[model samples]
Target: MPDPVLLVLDTAPSPRLGRLTGRVDVRHADASSLAGLLPAADVLLVWDAASDAVRAAWPGPGRRPGWVHTAGVRVDRVLCPELAASDTVLTNARGVFERPVAEYVAGLVLAFAKDLPGAPELRGRARHREVQQVAGARAVVVGAGPVGREITRLLHGLGVRVALVGRTARRTIHGAADLDRLAARADWVIAAVPLTDATRGMFDRRFFGLLQPSARFISVGPVACVVRSGLQDALERRWFAGAALDVSEGEPPGPDGPSRDVPGLLLSPYPSGATVGWRDRLGEQFVALYEQWARGEPLPNVVDKERGYVPSADLPGGAGPDPGTGPRVNGSAAPPG
Candidate 1:
């Protein structure tokens, strides 16, 4: 039998897969050429985690690779009904991004608190602003995954009181039921949750309305549920202090683009996970996983395809099986357990 074929959805700064060059039939394809290469492959590595190529071209059931791995934690880009229902084992780069993303959130909190970015821009116009102290701020971080935990850890290090919200309540973590209560008391609201059906539009009008007027909202991941018009309306009415979005609904405009026109809205092309030497780390991580795959060992970071993320139970410090907030997975609430 020939070597197992490895197909990669290539992007700029391609993963350095030299470690697998002689061991497998490694193939590379851009979005335009991906579908043509899916059938014969044994494994598919989604190197371009941000691209939707896989979602558009996932060959159904028997036609796809036996395993598919996304190089990022969120599998939203590649998740489709056909693939989710298939036997394919889906995995992600869970640990690789956690700390970097956490650091990004911390940096943003500091920048906002100290008025660093705003001060510089204001200084250009001979304006000076008072900076707030971060030592006593309170934060509510949605999503208790590795990324969320890391964010909580770093925020705590900075003396910020953090309340973590997961799908279910666990020791020291709040469930969805408590989000509104926590949001109303928080000074910072950070969204680090995965994009799923339940969480897709979670930060809607009602969610935003629950926040304190002095709170700053930061979305470190997809802004799936944050309706643009709702946010605009909130800003018009000065509902909250300000908002920052690393990811948006549509293609983000280029530098100095029209997205800057929105008052109290700060947008940055998603770079939370692109810290120094991150690519090298990603390449090393893939190589390690590739070795495990070659040895037929259980792969880590296996995503719960149905949930569109690595289930909480699979995470290192995650909550138990989702209690579905109100109680049962079914629509009925669990009897006062």
Candidate 2:
């Protein structure tokens, strides 16, 4: 029997797969070549998590890979109707990013609370101003998956009172039903949910309007969850104290992009989950999962295609299934939950 073909959607500084040598027939493809190669492969590895090539080419005529895996936590880039409805199993790199993203959120919370961004200006003017304390502050963290749980744990250590919200109300976690109420009273509102049909544009005008004016909003999840214009309006109108985002809608916004002019807004190019050696970690993770698949064992991090994320129930410390907020695409409208 021929070795099963493993097709890699290539990216710069490609994943080191030396260990798989002589065990499988490895192939490579760029966006332009992926469709032509899909029919011949038994497994697909999406190395470039940010590329939309998978979604674009997945529907083409072919017998798709039996299994597909992305090196990113979120599956939005690779999801399409055809793939979702197909029999292929989808997996993601989940565990690798949880701790890094949680730590990044903790750092952002501290920075905002202590007014760390203003330190340079204060030094220049030789002025002194009191900063807020993170202790005793109230926070509503949306998402109950591994990433969300990690954020909740770290925030608890900082003495912050965190309301961890999941899809449904559980023993210690709040449900999507309580989001508005919790957010309205929170000192910080953090979005950590995946991008799904329900959460795509959940943080829009109405949602922002529910926040306390002194509260700060931070998104560590898919950027499409936020409506750019809605957030800009809220910041301009002082509906909230400030906001920070780790991800951007498409490419990182340019210097002249609309986000640049938005007051009290901080933007980073989706680095929350990217610690040093993250790529290597991703590569190593894929190899491990691939081995499991080859042995016919159940693979972890299997994404719930219809829901667009790995169900929290499948993860250690997962709060539960995440019932998303509302259904809306980016910049569109959805009825209030």
Best by TM-score: 2
Q: What local lDDT score does residue 277 receive in model 2, on the 0 to 100 scale?
A: 87
lDDT of 2 by residue, 106-201 (tens): 998999888888777774564556789999899988987777777877787788888888777766667789999999999999898888888888
Q: Residue pairs in steric clash, candidate 2?
A: 167-323
Off by over 4 Å in 2: 59-62, 124-126, 248-250, 255-258, 318-337
Q: Rate the local accuracy (lDDT) of all candidates.
A: 0.76, 0.81
User: How much is 298 displaced in model 2, in angstroms?
Assistant: 1.1
TM-scores for candidates 1 onward, in order: 0.88, 0.90
What ranges in model 1 sit over 4 Å off? Answer: 13-15, 124-129, 248-251, 254-258, 317-337
